[model samples]
Target chain A: MDSGTESASADAWDGEIETEIGHDEYDPYGTLTLIGIYFVIIALLWVFMYFVEFLGEGPTVM
Target chain B: MEIHRYETIWFAASLLLIVGFIGTITYGAVGVGVEMVDDSGGTVDPDNLGSHERFGDTGVHKVNESHYEVNMIAVHPSFIPSEIEIPAGSTVTFYMTASDVTHGFKLVDSNLNTMIIPGQVSEITAEFDEPGEYGFVCHEYCGSLHHEMAGNLSVVPEDEWGGVDS
Candidate 1:
């Protein structure tokens, strides 16, 4: 093969694989789902602690 | 700089979280009418605490029909008038000072906590809605017997409460 053709083949064999996916088209549905769960948990804990642990624990200072 | 949509969303969520915390605290202060301890208790001389007017007669006193005042002194190893009795369903203000070193007063299971400095009086006001017995401790490490420095606060019923006269 010619030098240019050989170089091109070598570049292809160097572990570079082309794909149809683009950076902008990458969907992070899994990340969004995990973060949504985290948000719900944090909100619930906040409510429980504020209402149950704090306000319910009476004899507080006025 | 370019930012991802998810990053922007997360940033907004973090801001909302902070604002939510501040709002909750504000509601507790304004809506629930929770007050904090301030410098209104004034100052006193640690050396002459025995001769001071209020600390000299350290005990619980009924100020009015619904209000009470407690004058307390934190000495080295114990509190003067170790047992404090007050009436439930009344507002009680604690005026405290330390004689030798800095100390701490923390009423257990309650929100009353303050530092008792030698020359400064620490004051906190709390209301007891139910008759119960609570314990207080010197939370700050001042001396060798700091761990043993504790007291009791008894909130008795209105009918069972013997006022300062009794």
Candidate 2:
């Protein structure tokens, strides 16, 4: 997907969660799903860094 | 058969690169428990030592009094002042800063790996314990020309420096 759609979904999730926790609105409509997606992305990045050595030990020909 | 030859050569070259990368990382971070010195060295003053004139030397940079100061500008695949010769027992402080991106500053046979941020000077010091040819290169992959960023450092004894036998 394009970067714009990805970011829009992320921001929309954050907004929805904030609304759910506030007194003005109580719409918990699957906001936890957004949080799960965020965690998944973070975990994937951690794995990539651990094995691929991305930008850690300088540059490699391989 | 010709493709096999190419594959073998590629494999060999890649193996050497891996070895070099491992050496760089080891020298950069291994066996150093103490805290690293803050890399900010003295501010750059071209007129203080007239160092601006020494850029792009073909490997034997002539500095005065057998002792000198230098600024190794970070660029794609290498440091700006690529090759250098320093006298033994003297500390050569590298005033490093990247012009392009974040590059790794490290020395072979010593722990000097540091992140050189773009537009921010990071000072690193190195003292050669033995007079010999030491290999060093930028461990950070900035671009496709990364292999060309390699260079050699020669540490000569004080007596042999400046053509003086003393």
Candidate 3:
């Protein structure tokens, strides 16, 4: 079964000018990846410390 | 066979790991400790940066004793809200959510340090025992203007509030 509105919307075409100006030169992937890795490590350490906080000892940053 | 620059890469990685560890613990302290989550068990709202609203009227809010709510939206790079006004010597709950990336929310009066995740909300409740000018910061790494994400909260005397400014 096909709804009239849905089918009409799919077929309707009005050529629209793209308003977005794309940035093709910038690549932040590597930076983001590095940052992501950094936080993951810290989160693991915090989990380790949360349990330890109760014992009155947080891990030293050596 | 040509192998070169490997040492530099290793050095960088090591440095990055060390820095990351220090940062993460700070994050866990502010984010994990509070069990900071929203009504749906998810801290982030998938659409907006952190306001829990995907678009339009984005950002966190606060509720006063008289039940006056203020919405903090689109904080600029300076990390400071352009303006904040609250009744003096009153308890105002701050609800913060980032509209883009991660931002740190802290209050000078309360020393609140919390990481607000994009698409998630981080909430903090603070009481201004005395009326005064208070400033805040975004501690998390957000962007080129990370250092600039700052805002302020003002505490005014109860009488200062409009009589019906509930």
Candidate 4:
């Protein structure tokens, strides 16, 4: 059962590469975009936690 | 080292993020005046907590017009003088210690949080500018009724603030 699905999926990419792309021409913009989004999320969370949960909590230690 | 432009950008961004993180914490400490519970409370003998000067008489004491000191003791499943009452617009310094085991003291909705070890003391000071009620709990699990280990802190209006009710 596993061999049939494996071979069928493997055959789809069995063809040779039509064009070769070198490292200098490749750009991982997608990874950059993903990391940028993650950074924004983390920064937002830090602001909320620090400003709202911590500072806005009131009666903080002096 | 030869690095790609994208890698360089990512590296610079990462450095900025780290610096921003440190700057935020510094601002909190310096600008906002956030403090940590330290060894200022000093040490005590767990077995002789009853003989301690402050811990011996666990309750609220008025230092001056704007300052107050609260001496508290934490046992297995309860806090001595659990119902703490104080006046609003006052600064309070909580002196807490545990007699049996280690416990945590965390005032809900406030930054008044610390740990109470058997032989060690935890001291934290905070300013209550508004009149409100805060619930404090033992964040550490000590025994069977650890969840039930909680207390109430009432910051009443200055005019309505009566001395500690014996």
**Individual DockQ of the candidates?**
0.50, 0.01, 0.01, 0.61
Model 4, range A1-49, lDDT digits (tens) per residue?
Answer: 8999999999989999998987667788899899899988998998898
* Candidate 1 wrongly placed segments (more than 4 Å): A1-14
Name the lDDT of candidate 2: 0.57
What TM-score, over all chains together, does every model reach? 0.88, 0.46, 0.45, 0.88
Clashing pairs in 2: A58-B139, A58-B140, A59-B139, A59-B141, B39-B123, B77-B149
Per the 3 Å backbone cut-off, how many clashing residue pairs does candidate 3 have? Answer: 25
Tell me candidate 2's TM-score on chain B: 0.59
Give the number of the best model, judged by lDDT.
4
Q: What would the per-residue lDDT of candidate 2 be over residues A1-62, giving only the tens digit for each residue?
A: 69999998888757444323433244344654564566567656655653355334322111
Query: Which DockQ-derived CAPRI band holds candidate 3?
Result: incorrect
lDDT minimum window of 10 residues, candidate 3 chain B: B53-62
Worst 10-residue lDDT window, candidate 3 chain A: A53-62
Question: Mind giving the per-residue lDDT tens digits that candidate 1 earns over B1-166?
Answer: 7677777888998899889988888998989877778888899989998899999889998889999899999998898868998888999888999989998998888878888899999888888989999999999999999999999999999999878723
Query: How displaced is residue B166 in candidate 1, in Å?
Result: 7.2
Model 4, B85-136: lDDT tens digits are: 9999999998899999999999998888888998888988999999999999
True contacts kept of each: 0.69, 0.00, 0.00, 0.81
lDDT at residue A21 of model 3 (Cα atoms): 48
Off by over 4 Å in 2: A1-62, B1-35, B42-67, B163-166
Q: On lDDT, who's better, 1 or 4?
A: 4
Best by DockQ: 4
Alpha-carbon local distance difference test for all models = 0.87, 0.57, 0.53, 0.90
